[model samples]
Target: MGIVLNQSLKNTIITYLGFGIGAINTLYLYPFFLGTVFYALTNYILSWANIIMPLLAFGMQNTLVKFYTQYKTEEERSRFLSFTVLIPLLLCIPLVLIGLFFFEPISLYLSKENPVVKDYLWLIPFIGLSMAYFEIFYAWARVHMHSVFGNFVKEVGLRLFSLFALIGVYYEWISVVEFIYVTAIIYFLACIITMLYAFHIKKPVFQFSIPQNVKDVLVYTFFIILSGSVAVMLLDIDKIMLNQYIKIENIAYYSVATYIASVIAVPSRAMHQITYPITAKLMHENKHDELNDLYKKTSINLQVVGGFVMLCIFVNINQLYVMVPKEYSGGILVVFLIGISKYFDLILGNNNAIIFNSKYYRMVLFLGLLLVFLTVGLNMFFIPRFAITGTAVATLLSITLYSLAKLLFVVKRMHLYPFTHQTLYSLAITFGIFLSFYFWEFPFSPIISIGLKSALVTLLYVYINYKFVISIEINQALDLVLKKLKIRL
Candidate 1:
């Protein structure tokens, strides 16, 4: 319990820092500099690239997390590291070749409305290779329990690089075409730096020995590849499919809403990355009590923080759209629907880490593919009829079903639920604040009033939690931060 709090405190600080930068990028910079259309293009491209990354990576990142603790010998560990890194590199070459071979056909299919993606398909191999390398190094760093550097690269460094690209676009130093290449270059550089840092931590040798466990791990890797690709595709394929089925500009509208809504889920993603290894370690050490405690705390903490963000977005989203062009305001329901889904995910806490690292992890993926198919069906059905709203609806329902399935799996198999009274407490508090303002008249526009309401909601939330002590994890976390800062309180 203490250790989880301590790590979470550190992670919370880091998450906030990353979120600060992310907020600027998502809200102000992307819109102000790139415009919503170009911004959507960039986001959609990356999302598709990531969806393809797991296929190219062949599950090395996941295999790294699972097998790191199992091997003992330096020789064995070094061999495993090499295997993890090389297998992805190997997988990418063939993938790139296959993509190149099918370039015209695939591009024609994907770019039914916008064939610009054909020129962009070449960028996928570069994007995939970097994505593959970054995951390998990210895994290597996680195995050493040094998430700060990897997290910085992922959460901060990559954003910082994109920040520069936005600057270039703003200056008119490059066309959007050049902007795409520069972004891919940023990913590649981040990957190189990550691997260098991992090597500095533990110089992995290039040994290729086959241990008994190696075969089993490789089998697991194959399953993980399919599962991971499916997960990424579920999250991203809508934009790609939308491009194929409709105009490219519709993707811009959908992407903006998704980007805004996704910000609500960033804290959960950051915390899960830090928590996964520790959860794996604890489970290995027969620490079920600690594991369940951490899970409950994570669930409550995520809801509290995530609910506050959701309130702010839901309240201020109208103002936000005013900042963007009026056309994107067409996506109001898209933002609301997607935002609701992300909030539901927050309540699930570290569910992804919990299930993906567990013995019953395979079951999570099996159901995940089913949800992926469902998502595709929903997208196909909705995009043609309702357009962006349909896509958002599909995302909400598919993701909700997906999350419920994983939560059920964790509870049923482990008999460990990741919730508590405090989880309900957070929800109740959010409800009270929302109801307080639901019917209240405001002197100003939604743009102005929403911000004011958000401030009040944030204050009420903090005050109530301070008084009632929502989660012991949060209290301990505050104390840890205070002690670190040499404050008596």
Candidate 2:
């Protein structure tokens, strides 16, 4: 837990900083600077790119994390790394060729509701390829137990560049069309930088020979690709589907609301970077006891942190919406719906890492694939009738069902459960704080009101959790921070 706490904290800070920049861009810059039409176009292209990213990389990112620890000899490790890296590059060729071959009809289909997307069809695969390699390299870093730099590049670097691009658009230095292309270039550069940083972490041996367990590697990669695609599709498919049913501008609305809700996920994302490799190592070593301990700890700690963020978002949601445009305010319901779904997923902690690394992964992958169909079916049925609100409902239901299944599978197969008494206490505290704060507001500007209310909420929440000692790990963390600041608890 030492390295987990160390790196997870760093990653958490980096992710929120990224999300902070993203908040500004999503809430203010993208909407106000580019207008709704082009803003939606930007999100539409990126969402499609994200959906296709797993196939392009061939799931090497997750495959590396899962299998990297099992090999004994350095030679074998190098060979496996080579296999994970090169195979994805090789397999991407045919996928790109297929896209190019059917480019026209694909573009026509996607651009049905919004013709603006037709012009940027090329960026979809291009950006997806970039995202694929970025994750591959990021996994490369993670396997070495050095996730901070790669995480910084992913979380902070990309959003920072996008912020500058938005400024360029504001200054008339770049047209919105040019800004769109620039965003693709930003992703491409991020991929390159992460690759170099990965190489620096551990100089590549670049073995051309195949790993001894090529069969296992290939098989796992195949299942992982489908599963990875299922997960990404679940997250981004709402945006893509929105393009088909609602106007393109509605996606901009949906994106902003979802982005706000997604801030609740930062702690989970941060912890997973390191916990993933750790979970794989524990599973590979068959250390069930330690794995169960990790499962419980990650569950409670993430619940505590994620629940805090959710509380802040829920209480301040109305005030938060006041800052956005009038049209975008329709997503208020979308925030609560998506935020609850995400919080449920969050409290499950390392449930994903545990399942993906375990022997029962094949069954879970099938379940995930079926859920993908369910999500699409729900989106199709709901989006036309209810617009973005319907899409949010579909997302909430699908994600809740998916998360619940994973939780039950872990409990049944491994006899491992993440919830403890702390979990219940955390939930109780979150509800108490939310109820107390939700109806209260500062009679000030949106920014000042949010700050004042959030401060009071944070102090109250932290005091109660600290007093109860809901998690020893969290209490220890608080002690360190308070000690550093020369304060006594």
Candidate 3:
């Protein structure tokens, strides 16, 4: 908690702000205008960008976080940062060349539609290259203990830009196909902005210096590459698999459900951004007890926050889907499954942070690769038969298993746990609310039916939480607010 304890309120607010806008983009705009296939392709290509980006970055984002704190002086930090940036540039050439050489096979494998696949495949490396440096410079911000701007670019700026693009397509200002590629180009341009903004702040002096201890950095990079690749594989392989087995249109359906479900995971993503650098710093300082405590608190905090979100979405999923066309309703199930999978990740909290920042990370990386392999295999087995449902089931099972594996390792090896009374109560209350609405049925229009059900669900979940889940501090704060209002009889 100490590592990320500072400025958490601000970060949380920013995360919510980002999530609010992003929710509209995802839930309303995407489903309303894009249809299922395009919606899914949007998510798929973006994630695919991440899948290939790590390879291009040469795994230096992890390297930057790991090494940046070692330097005390600005000069030393600059040299290391420069070296980090330079090596990735040196690495990107090969990725471009390989991606060019392998474009058709990659496209054929990535999707069956393959309509604009050739046109879009070229954007992969460009987006990947941008991601490579975005991370490198973003790490620059993180190690400096600044999270707000990095998050602004990541969560706010890019999505806001896309919202305008989406509007452009809505008005036929740009063709949908062109807009798709344009969004990728926007990602690259945003990366440049992030890098430039980083320079504006750190203004790291890039002096020529010998790379520091090549052996250790390379060793770290090896494990991180495996870690990075496997992490991206798990996060993304579902849509990629969806493309291979199902129509690209199905990808759109899955994407909508995914967007709804994934909103619950945003807290973890934001928290992880700040927590990573702190974990790196903690491990270097050998503050085991502090690290363990922070890990537990983060898990509990995320569960409490993420549980509320998951409850909201899981309860009102029917209503939320009403905003979309009839065909995408199938994604509701996928939404539930994916939401649960992400919830498991939230419950585990900063286990990855603890592992990645620890000396024990390489072994964890090996275990992660195993999980990635299993996830791929399971998706292959299931997606052929169940389609979107199959993909959801595959993702849920694999992610839960992976989180459990990490949880057990951390408990066994470090003698730590992330659960307590609050965790139990939150889950119990959430489940009660979820099941409360599970039996409700209404004979009305989809819009009206959904709205009514969602309202009831929200009220019930809030009531349960206020009674059992919300903190004493929150209660006190509410009391203060009430007292200030001086309500009349």
Candidate 4:
């Protein structure tokens, strides 16, 4: 718990910094600097890449995390690592060949509705290939408990580079077309850096020998591909589908709303980095008691953190939208629906890590595939009728169903639950704070209004949680901060 707390806190700060930069890029730079067409194109390209990344990598990233600890000898570990690293290339080569043979047909299919996407079709696979290797290397680093640096490069470095690229577009130093190409280059660069850092942590002793548990390893990897694909599909498929059903520019509007709502997942994202490997190791050791304890602690702590974020977003949504362009103001409902969905995901804590590392993973993958179909079905039914708002509704429905299924499976099979009495208390407090602050407004600019309201909500929320000791872990964290500042709570 000590290491988890220290590293999660550090990772949270870094993740929030990354999101802060992303907020600027998503809200101001993309919409204001780049026109909606270019902004939507950029977002669409990246979303396409994200959806394809798992297939390109062939699930090696997750396989590495799940199996890295099972090997006992250095030679065995080397063989496993070597095999996982090369497996993706095998998948990548075939994919590239297919893309080459079918490029025209594929481009026409994607761009029939939005002709702007035709020119950028090549960027999708190229960026997806880069993103695939980035995750492969990131998982390599995570297994060594060296996640912060990789997290920084992934979360902060890419956004920082994008910020520069957008500035170039703004100043006319680079054309929008060049900026699009530069985006792919940025992902490839990040991949190279992460691979290098991973090697620095522990250089792989390349071995072509087969692992002892090759059968199990291969089986797990196969199922993980589905799992990884399902997860990515849930997150990015809406953007991709939106490009199909509506004008490309509407994606830019939806992207802004989704990005704002995504802040709710930051705490879960940060905590999962360290907790993932820890969870894997614990499950491998069959330490159910400790794993159960971790499950509850993470759930409550994340709820406390993520719930506050949702509260702030729901309360300040109007002011936040005022800062963006009027064209994007239509995504208010998108924010609320997706924000609640993400908050639900956060409170489940490291449920994902636990399931992915456990034997029940294959069953979850089956469920995931069904939900993927459901998501597409819902999107197809809703998007043409309601446009961007309908897409959000579809996402909300799919994620809610998916999350509930996962929660139930974990409870029934693993006999572990993330909720406690404090779970209900946390929800009640969140509702109370939101209702109290949703209508409250300040006579100031959007920025100042957000700041004042956020500060008030945060102070009140934290003080009440601390007073009740909703989570001993959170309370202890607050106590540590106060003591460091020579102040008493």
Clash number for every model?
0, 0, 3, 0
lDDT of 2 at 154: 88
lDDT of 2 by residue, 1-489 (tens): 999999999999999999999999999999999999999999989999998999999989999999888898988898888888898888888877887899999889988888888998899888999999999999999999999999999899999999999999999999999999999999999999999999998789897799888889889889999999999999999999999987899999999999999999999999999999999999999999999999999999999999999998999999999998899999999999999999999999999999889889999999999999999999999999999999999999999999999999999989998998888899999999999999978899999999999999999999999999998999998998999999986
In the order shown, what is each candidate's alpha-carbon RMSD?
A: 2.6, 0.9, 2.9, 0.9
Badly placed stretches (over 4 Å) of model 3 are 1-6, 108-113, 441-489
User: Candidates 1 and 4: which is better by TM-score?
Assistant: 4
lDDT by residue for model 1 (1-489), tens:
554555565666676677678767776777778776677678767877798788877888878887788778888888888888776766567766777788888777776687666667767767877887798798888878777778788877888778878788889988767888898899999999999999999987786656558778877887788888877887888887788687777887787788788878877876776688887777777788888977887898888888888877776676677676677788878988999989998898777776766777777778988998999999999999999998989999998898888888888889889887777888888878767765564578755776687778777777787667887667666677778999763
User: What's the CA RMSD of model 1 in angstroms?
Assistant: 2.6
Q: For candidate 2, list the clashing residue pairs, or say none.
A: none
- Please provide TM-scores, in order, for all candidate models, with all chains considered together: 0.93, 0.99, 0.91, 0.99
- The residue ranges of model 1 lying beyond 4 angstroms of the native Cα positions read 1-3, 35-37, 438-451, 479-489
Q: Where is model 2 more than 4 Å wrong at Cα?
A: none
Model 4 CA RMSD to the hidden true structure, in angstroms: 0.9
lDDT of 3 at 278: 81
Q: Where does model 4 exceed 4 Å of error?
A: none
Q: What is candidate 1's TM-score against the reference?
A: 0.93
- 257-339, model 4: which lDDT tens digit per residue? 99999999999999999999999999999999999999999999999999998998999999999989999999999999999
Q: Quick one: ranking by lDDT, best first? A: 4, 2, 1, 3
CA lDDT scores, all candidates in order: 0.79, 0.93, 0.78, 0.94
What is the per-residue lDDT of model 3 for residues 1-489, given as tens digits with 9 covering 90 to 100? 444644465676787787778877887787776666667667777778889877778888888898888878777777888888888787667766876798778777665554534456666667778877888888878777887787888878888888888898899898778778889888888889989888887886776575667778888887888888888888788887877776777877787778778889877887888888887888889888888777777787777778877876776677677777788788888988999899989988788877777677777888888888889899999999889898889889888888888888888887767777877887887787778776666778766776687677766665666567354433444466668998321
